[model samples]
Target: MKIALVGIGKIAVDQHIPAINDSPDWELAATVSRHGSVDGVDAFTDLGDMLDARPDIRVVSLCLPPVPRFAYAMQALAAGRHVMLEKPPGATLAECHALTAKAQADGLSLYATWHSRQADMVAAAKEWLTDKRLTRLHVTWKEDVRRWHPGQDWIWEPGGLGVFDPGINALSIVTDILPHPIHVTGATLKVPENRQTPIAVNLEFHHPQGAQVTADFDWRQEGDQIWMIEAETEAGTLTLTDGGATLKINGERSGTAAPLGGEYPRLYAQMAQLIADGGIDMDLRPMTLVADAYTLGRRETVAPFHD
Candidate 1:
């Protein structure tokens, strides 16, 4: 199917373009971006122009930031096209719901993609934890924002999600793997003095089966980055590291390591399947956890972050 990519940012160039090009089910028909464009592809500065010009492009994949995603998604759905959204779906939960409603009303597919859940070992981890009796789960996600997102001013602004931008990836895995449901009980957010969002956060959750669940997210790490989740159950310990690309059972590696961009390929394949099945998979469990953190967290003013 022909698909038009909406944003041509770092992620679109690095992951989305490659995934679409490699997928047999999709073609890079066009792109809509203000400052970036793909080579040898029809590019437009506005989405409305792309929609009006190419009705053959039935799928519109939005790689834009969460703040502006809802409008683009609604526009695509209004044009009777299948819409695929990047992680977190939208800046607000209500907007996501409205998009879902509009998609259903229009009989078009709407996919709120969470690329992390498609990580190789995530399914393996979920399978192992399915029958086990959970005891405790801890998520430690830290990275240097300057190294990953340098000079991205929007991230420090309100609704940018700050540390939770990457932190939500861990939540996506947690919410998908665990057998029991969990919700936020308490949280501590470390907001930079000059920024609206938190640069660091410590989240606590109430597990239904009395398991101790917590997460630590910080965008101030220096050396080797960390994206690890350790889950303890009555059977044994299951650890997912390297953003769910690697799995360990009781300190020993258990699953085969997948290549770096495995997630995006699977995400595109899933989007194709969603369109084929005429379904909407707009899971908001991960986003809900982040939203609850914002609501329950006690903010602490930290030193100003420059970058």
Candidate 2:
């Protein structure tokens, strides 16, 4: 399938490009960005121009930030193209719903991708936990923002979602593996004094089965990064680490590591199948959890973050 990739930012360059290149079902037909482009693909600064010129490209994958994504996505759908979105879907849940409606009205496929849920071991972990009655599930996702986002100031803005940007990846995995639904009960958001978004967060959830569910997200770790989820159930303890790339059951390794390029390839494959089947996959459970945190959380101003 011919696809145009919009927003040639760090993630587009680092993950999307290689994933598209490696996939057998996709072609990087064109790009829309102000300052970034693939070496040989045709590029445009405006999405409208790309849609007009490249009608052959049936799919448009948006890698842009959440704030400006809705406009581009709507434009593409209006142009009669299938749409695929990065994590969290949109700045607001309403926008995601609007896009979904647009796609359905246009008879197009819309994929709201949660790449972390595609991690190699995530399926295995979900399968293992399918029959177990959970007693506890805790997510610890901490990373250095300077290392991952670098100079991206958009993240500190209101809709950028701060730590929840990466934290949502964990929630994606959590929502996918668990058998029952969960809702946020309480939360504490630690916002930097200089920024509008939180740099750290603690979330507590009310599990339908009365299990203890909590998540801790921070962007302050310096050394080894940690992305792990431990779930203690009636059967055994299941641990998913390395962002669902590895899984362990009761302290014993459970599966092999993911393939060379990891989650994006799988996402692209799923997108291809979705397009073929004329289906829309816009599961917003993870985003709902994040929104609930913001709505229910208590805010605290922390030390100002520089850079």
Best by lDDT: 2
**Candidate 1 lDDT over residue span 187-260, tens digit each:** 99999999999999999999989999999999999999999999999899999999999999999998688876
Candidate 1 wrongly placed segments (more than 4 Å): none
The Cα RMSD of model 1 versus the native structure comes to 0.6
Error of 1 at 135 (Å): 0.7
Point out where model 2 deviates above 4 Å.
Answer: none
RMSD of each: 0.6, 0.8
All candidates' lDDT scores? 0.94, 0.95
User: What is the TM-score of candidate 1?
Assistant: 0.99
User: Model 1: which residue pairs collide?
Assistant: none
Query: In candidate 2, what are the lDDT values of residues 87-134, reduced to their tens digit?
Result: 879999999999999999889999999999988899999999999999
